[model samples]
Target: MALNLNDLQIFVQAVDSGGFAAAARRLGMPKSTISKRVAALEADLETRLLHRTSRSFMLTDPGRDFYEHALAALIEAEAAESAVRQRHAEPSGIVRITASVPAAQFFLSDHLPSLAVAYPKLTLQLHATDRFVDLVQEGFDIAVRNHFAPLPDSELLQRQVSIDEVILVAAPSYLEKHGFPADPRDLKNHAGLLVSQTAKAWRLHHVDQGTISVSPHCRFIADETLVLLRAAASGLGIACLPETGCKAAMEHGQIVRVLPGWTAGTVATSILTTHRRGQLPGVRAVVEFLAKGFQAERAATGNVLEPLRETTEARS
Candidate 1:
C-alpha cells in the first residue's frame, strides 16, 4: 500500500502539538483538516491511531510506536536536506586535478600554498603528466592544458587562463662560444636543446610583427622541460621554453634570452572541466584560484627579461 507522507506528517505534528486544534494552529491549517488527515493515515494503515472524544485526546499503543519511527525518519530527512545545502555553500572535499609536468611544477604548484590557506577544507590530488587525460573516464575534476594552436573541439568546457610566450634561452657561456643569432635564419647554425629530435622547426614572431620559421640543429633532446632547462643552463644549446618557466633562471643570470626581439611562439594555457558552470564548490574554488594566479604570474614574469635584455644590448 502507498503510504500518504502528508498524512504521516500531520499525524506526527498532531501528537506533538497535543491535539488536532493545536497542530492546525502550528501548521496554519483548520482543525477539521488536521483531524481528517490523521484519520486518513489510520485508515491507510488499517489501525486505530488515536482515541478522539469531546474533552480528551489520546494515542493507541500502535499509534505511539508509529509516532516514534515517523518522527525519527522526519528528522533524518531534514538533516539530509541541510547537508546537501551546505555543500553548495562551502568548499569541502577532494578535487582531483591533472596537468603537464611543467605546468604542475612552474604554474600550478606556486598557487597551492595559498589555496590551502584560503580553503582549509579542500584537498587537492594532482596528477602531473604530459599525456592527455580523459576527464570523465579518468574521474578527474580539472585539467590544465597548454595548446600551441587553437584548441580542438571537445566535450570538456575550456577556459583560457593565460598566454605563455615561448622564447629561446641559453647559458651565457654557450652564447659567447657559439655567438648570438643576428637574424632569425642565423638560428639554423646554432645547436638546439630540443624536446623532440624529429627535425622540429621553430616559428618565431618578431617585435616588428614579422615571422620566420627555422629548423635548429638538435644537440640534446628531452621531452621534459626541466631537462631542457638544465641542458641550456649547462651551456649545451639554445632551448625554447615558456617565459614563465625561464623567469627565475633569467633573473639569476643562469641563462639569458637568445635573439631578444623574437619569440618561438605563444601558447594558450587553459582549464578544462566537465561542466561550464555550477560545478562543485571545491572544484569551482580551485578553477577560479588557478585562473587568477596564472594571470598574475604572467604579468609578473613579463619584465624578468629587462635586466638580461639591457646586458645583451650592451654586448652587441
Candidate 2:
C-alpha cells in the first residue's frame, strides 16, 4: 500500500508542535482525530514511531529517522504547491513573518496597513518575539531583525534594509535630577538601563575624536528594548536604544536624547527569507514593501546623530 501524505503531514505536525493537542490547535482539528490518524499511520507502517506518555511523548529511534525524511518530503510538497500558485498573476496567500518585538512594535506594525492596501488578497501572520526563530522549522516566510553583529552563517537569503542609529536617552525629570553629562566619560556617573542582548560597552564614534567606549554602571538590565525604554522614561536609568524605537518617546517629551552629539553605534536591519520561499509573490511583495519603507524612513529622519556636535559644543 502507498504511504498517505495526509497521515504523514499530521505526524510531522504532531512532532514539530511537541504534542498532539498542539498540532490539533495549529491545524484547527480535533485532538482525538489527530491522534487517531497518527495511530493509523503507525499501523500502516507496521512500526511504532512514538513513545507515548500521559504528560508528554518522545520519538523512538525509527521515528527520528522517519521524521527526518518526512519533513523533507513535506517541504518538497509545499514547494510544489507554491510553485503552482506562483504561476497565477495576483499575489494571494498567507505569508508568515517573524520579527523582534521592538521592530514589530515601532517599525513593522505601523507599515502593515499599507501592505494590506497594496495587496488586498494577501494574508499576513506576524510572530513578534526576541528569540531567533528557525525560519524553516517554524514555517515562517520572512524574518526582520536588527543586529549590531554580522548575521550568523546560514543558507537563508538576507537583504540589508537600513543602518539604524543607536542613541542614549533618559527622561526629562531624570536628566534634571542627575544633570546632563558634559562628556561621554561622565555617563559612568549616572544610572544605566541596559539592553542585555547588546554589547556591554557602549561604543560611540565621532568623526574627529574617533571612537570612545564607555561601560555604564547598569541599575537595570532587560532583554527587551521596550522595557529599557520604559525604564528610562520612568527615570530608572539612561538607556541605549535604536532611534526608531525612541523617536515617539522623544517627540512626546517622555524621553530625551542624553548624549546628543555622540551615538552608541549603528545596527543593521535586514529582512531574511529562504531562497525557495522568496520566489513566492506574497513573500516577495512584503520584502519589497519593507525594504522601501525603511529607506523612506531613513531619508525622512536624516542622520539623528549628526546634530549632536553643535548641541554638545554649546553646552561645553
Candidate 3:
C-alpha cells in the first residue's frame, strides 16, 4: 500500500497540536477520522508510531524521528504549493514575527502600514516581548534580534539588516548636576543605569585611544534597554543607549550624547528564519520590506554619533 501524504500530514499535525482531538479540531475533521488516518499511516510503514492509551498519546522512538522528518516534509510541500499559487495569485498568508518590545515599537510599528498597503492580501502577526522565542517551536516565521557579538550557533539562518551604535547618554538636568565626563574614565564617578544583560564592565572604544573598560556605580540595573533609556531620561543616571532609541530625545534636548568620540559598542540587528521558511514568498516579502525600511531609517539619520571634535558646552 502506498503511504498517503494526507496521512503523514495528519500525523505531524497531531504531534504538533499535542493530541488527536486537538488536531481534529484544527483540521476541522472528526476525531475518529484523524485517529484512523494516523493509524493507517503507521500500518503502511509496518510499525506503531504512537503509543496511545485512554488518557495519553506518546510518540515511540521511531515516531519521534518520523515526526521530525515528517514536519520538514510537510513544510516543504506547503511551500511548494504556496510558490505555485503565488505564481498565479497574490501573496496571501500569515507571517508571524517575533522581536523585542523596543524593536517592535521603534523599528517595526511605523512601517507596518506601508506593508499592509503594498501587500493588501497578506496578514502579519507580531509577537513583541523581550524574551527570546524558539522560532520553530513557537511557530514564528521570523525573528528580529540585536546582538553585539556573534549569534549563538543554531540551525536558523540570520541576515544582518542594520548596525546600531551604542553611545553614552544623560538627561540635561542630570548632566548639569553631575557634570559631563571629559574622558571615558570619568564615567566611573557618575551614576549609571545599566542593562544587566551587558558585560560586567562597560567596554568603550575610540578611534585613536584604543579601549577602556569601566564598571560604573549603578543607580539602577535593568534587563530591558528601553528601561535603561527611560532611567537616564528621568535623570536617574547615565545610560549607554542605542543611537536610534535616543535620537528623538536628543533632538528635543531631553537627553545629550556624552563622549561623542567614544562608543560603547556596535550591535548588529538581524532577521532570522529557518532555511525552508525563508524561501516562502510571504516571509521573503516581509524580510525585504523590513531590511529596506531599516536601511532608509539609518540613511536618514546619517552619522548618528559623529565625534564633535571640540567639546560643546553642556545644556544650561
TM for every model, in the order presented, reads 0.69, 0.66, 0.66
TM-score of 3: 0.66
Candidate 1, run of 10 with poorest lDDT: 307-316
Top-down TM-score ranking: 1, 3, 2
What pairs collide in candidate 3?
Answer: none
Q: C-alpha displacement of 229 in model 3, angstroms?
A: 1.2
lDDT of 1 by residue, 1-316 (tens): 8776677789899998889999999999999999888877888789998888988889899988999988888888788888688666878889888898888888878887789889999898999988878888888988887777876676667777777789899999999999988887998899988888674888889879699889888799998888899999999999999888999899999999988879987776778877633267788888888887887786686632311110111100
lDDT of each: 0.82, 0.84, 0.82
Candidate achieving the largest TM-score: 1
Write model 3 residue lDDT over 1-316, tens digit each, in one string: 6556788889988998989899999999999999889877887798899989988889999999999888888889898998788656666799999987878878888887889889998899898986778888889988987777766777887777778888999999998999989988888898888877365578999999999998778789887877788888899888888888888788888899999879988876778888778778888888878888877777777953332111112110
Q: Which segments of candidate 1 are over 4 A away from where they belong?
A: 1-88, 207-209, 276-278, 303-316
Give candidate 3 regions above 4 Å deviation: 1-89, 197-200, 303-316
Local distance difference test, candidate 1: 0.82
Instruction: Give the best candidate by lDDT.
Output: 2
Candidate 2 — what's its lDDT?
Answer: 0.84
The Cα RMSD of model 2 versus the native structure comes to: 17.4
Model 2 lDDT per residue over 1-316, tens place: 8888888899999999999999999999999999999898889889999998998699999999999999999899999888787756587899999998878988998998889888999999999987889999989999988888877777788887778788889999998999999888998888888767365678887667788989888789898888888999998878988898888888999999987768877876778888889888889889888888887777777853322111111100
Instruction: State in Å the error of residue 114, model 1.
Output: 2.3
